[model samples]
Target: MKQGAQGSAATGAGDVPGSAVRVPPQSRGAADADVDVDVEVGRERYDAPGGVRGEHTHSETPLPRPRPAVQRASVRGQIVDALRTALVAGELRPGEVYSAPALGDRFGVSATPVREAMQQLALEGAVEVVPNRGFRVVERGRRELAELAEVRSLIEIPVMLRLARTVPAERWAELRPLVEASVRAAASGCRATYAEADRAFHRAVLALSGNEQLVQVAEDLHRRAQWPLVGGPGLRGRAELVADAAEHTALLDALVARDLDVVRALVGEHFRGAR
Candidate 1:
């Protein structure tokens, strides 16, 4: 499965500047060229509501002197998070031109923050700036994504194994609620919610490993995989959901019991389905 499968480009309808755009080079080698994302992101233009333009105002009634920094930081954090979610959800696709004006309109803010957010995304390798075009999506190919999955497994399963050894019996008590959330969300037919819950379950398992960096990398890979995996075909069926729930159960059991082989096999099975 391709990681973050949506084409990473966004189109701004010619209103944004070219220098603001960045295009990532295609990553797939010869074997994967036939894969194509038919989904288009900017087909219809969304206009701002009448008489309201995209701009932000510093709160005028603020009494505290330190409030300005806090407010600015808060808004900046929101903008960056929104942009990241947009990219991960395929609200933007690769090679599409991103118009700061259009995004500002959609986000109900002025172009400045939109521009700043794009820059931040670019720095994170989430989006790129095109020399002559506005922002475009970064293209991640199938093989590359698969390789990333392999790297993730390498980092994750061992931590799970070590975690199996150290976590006290009482701490094992915490995972059931997360597992229950996965079951319920799966039944509810919300793939996003289910996936998040599912990720939480796995994360909880690894958290016991006591290695923060490894956990962090696993999380980054998982987050990077979200757009592709959720958007995949065969992702919405009840059987798929049930299978995932079962897998989570099996994984948790294996960890609690210190069953290394079961843990490895469960992790492998999960990634295979992802492909």
Candidate 2:
């Protein structure tokens, strides 16, 4: 699962071609005349006037500050994220073989990170590795999608119902932001964004159950359901996503009200519609 400037200029009296030499304090007024004074030189270089040319006096410009380095882990994670988005958007068609080097060129990254990201996807069951070739996007159909949704419903609906009875209304209300995020993402018509927000909302709700194992299992199932189908419309249209998101809001309200019947109904309908 995708788990988603300054410039400065300075001139001194030393600018004067014939100004008094700025000697070190130790050289002029310090009690310890024999003591060495270490002067830390900056990157900036100064050139002496032509008449006073010295060995150290040559034209030089300060090197530009190094840009922040992109870590290898970060690159791999980004590739994973991008691949997930592509999967949801149907841009990465199911059953299509994609080589790491080819996808690396598409993402403008090195093939190593792409390969690492593909390996992670393979673990998630989003793709399968093909020896001497590349990874192939797993082909999922409506039947599989429905099965995943049913499994999720079997796991999540009971937990949510139990939580509704035990967990406080305020606890459920805290998930409003996640539900609203789903709504906004759905309205934006970005399947990838909506997919993530959808999972996040459900995950947050399940997390209230205080069962990490349940949450993990439910989240994995939820992610699998969101993957594109092999045939037919793999991704829902904006209207469908919006309607689905609205059910989340309604479900949240029912949970907050501790209406077990309403929560159960909403959850059942939501999962059915997921098919």
Candidate 3:
């Protein structure tokens, strides 16, 4: 009976030796290699607050890393964008020869891309690519601008008037955001923003016609018309842009009210006054 008692004491409550102890793998010491792997993968570990010494409970989360610099894939596309902006801003003067190499140096790029982009602009009639020479910005003096205004008025006015009379009021309501953008651009005297807003407004208006061809023609002409007047704000100054933006507001107001007479008057004034 005494020997049995001793055996029971040795085997009871983990007193038998290492083979009798029971513990979960998680409660064991964590490996330092695991922490290093987590940190290397942009993961962070944070322990719970006010915990016991043996309680190594932790939470792991992904941390944000620094983003690498991005670059455009197409040098030609970049060259084209820069050339068009310069052309529209009138930075490239009309009736002057600008060589591809010179323009390439100005843009800090190679001549090949510049030449390629100028070829596209040549097709747009914004520039003329001369044989053996570089290129020349087409002279768009006041008369040309006036003629462009006349063409736009001819195409856009009638379509806008028709849509005002027929299109649903809700459809026209969508123009509010675009008009607001124009107002902001005008206030800032940013020619590029104003151009974008103006283009969006006119394109949206023409789209209601259901004639894709007409919309395409009008938008193309709009881009060309915008390219000529590159100084401060085209024709006048910042005030003109503000005034132009106001005309857009007044026109929308007339459209919502379904007042054809007012719309006609506003459209006529907008195109004529711009000229």
Candidate 4:
């Protein structure tokens, strides 16, 4: 009914009551006729008494708008995220050199943002800076990845086992959503999303140990293990990702059940397969 009332009220001068009627554009004096009147549907503006515009009341808080610099920073962040994804997917080959301008062209962005993004990757050890050129994807040997996986297992397996024994089933059940998120990401076959979700799930589990330092070290190792390997198996297939994701669900189930034997076996197998 309110919609109908508003629609009829916004029709035109013919619908207005009494002296508040709007004069026809051509019949008004030259000064009045020269004024532009824009009436947008769904954004109707009502004229108050004496030809004044009524003020609209807002019940919601105004959202903050990002400024130009913030927008530029956001663009750079997006490029960094994309580059990391590419690195994980093996789209950026190890030992290969990539110029910011070339990558900028590929991403349809300016070279400045790409350069900034590459600088961030450099910090992350994913790429290294090349003077007078661009960045090169750091070549990671199979040994290096294997070693990282071993280190992660050394740190995480014990903590996970400890948590499985100590933490209540309800706490473990709270992590089901995170495990499901990893499964969804893996199913989509986006290595970047899956990598992040995977890390988040592990980090949540380790956080239950109440040891910030251990969690930080374990997370760093986990991330390094996911980097593209030199001369190793290429980008992992969807089936592989799905299998990896299923292990996450299985591990959570074991943890919730407080099954130490199953948790230990799954954790060991998961890290070994990660290499």
| Predicted model with the maximum TM-score | 2
1-275 in candidate 2: lDDT tens per residue? 00001111323223333322222221223343322211123322333332222222134233343333457888999999999889888898999999999999999998999999999999999999999999999998788877887888789888988999999888877899999999999999888899899989888988887899998998888878888887734447999999999999999999888999999899988987762
- Residue-wise C-alpha lDDT for candidate 1, range 1-275, written one tens digit per residue: 12223354433332334222222223355443323322122232222222222221243231222234466666667888787666644567655678777888988988777888888878767678877566877766667668767877888777766777777656876797887888887787655566678778778777777777867878777766654432333434766777778777777777677788998898877765542
Put down candidate 3 lDDT per residue, 73-179, tens digits, no spaces.
Answer: 27778888788778655578778789999999999988888998898889889899777989988877667777888898899889998999898888889988988
Better of 1 and 4 by TM-score: 4
Candidate 2, residue 124: the lDDT equals 97
lDDT of 1 at 38: 20
Best by lDDT: 4
User: Between candidates 3 and 4, which one is better according to TM-score?
Assistant: 4
Flag regions of model 3 displaced more than 4 Å: 1-74, 229-234
Q: How big is the RMSD of model 4?
A: 12.4
lDDT of model 3 at residue 205? 83
Better of 1 and 2 by lDDT: 2
Cα deviation in Å at residue 144, candidate 4?
A: 0.8
lDDT of 4 by residue, 1-275 (tens): 12221132333432333323232222235444233222233334443333534322244232233254678999999998899878887789888999999999999998999999999888879899999888999998878877887888788888898998899999999999999999999899877778899899999999999999998988878887898888733557778888999999999999989999999999999998773
CA lDDT of each prediction against the hidden true structure: 0.63, 0.77, 0.70, 0.77
Better of 1 and 3 by lDDT: 3
Q: After TM-score superposition, what is the CA distance of residue 156 in candidate 3 from its true location, in Å? A: 1.2
Candidate 1 is scored at a TM of 0.65
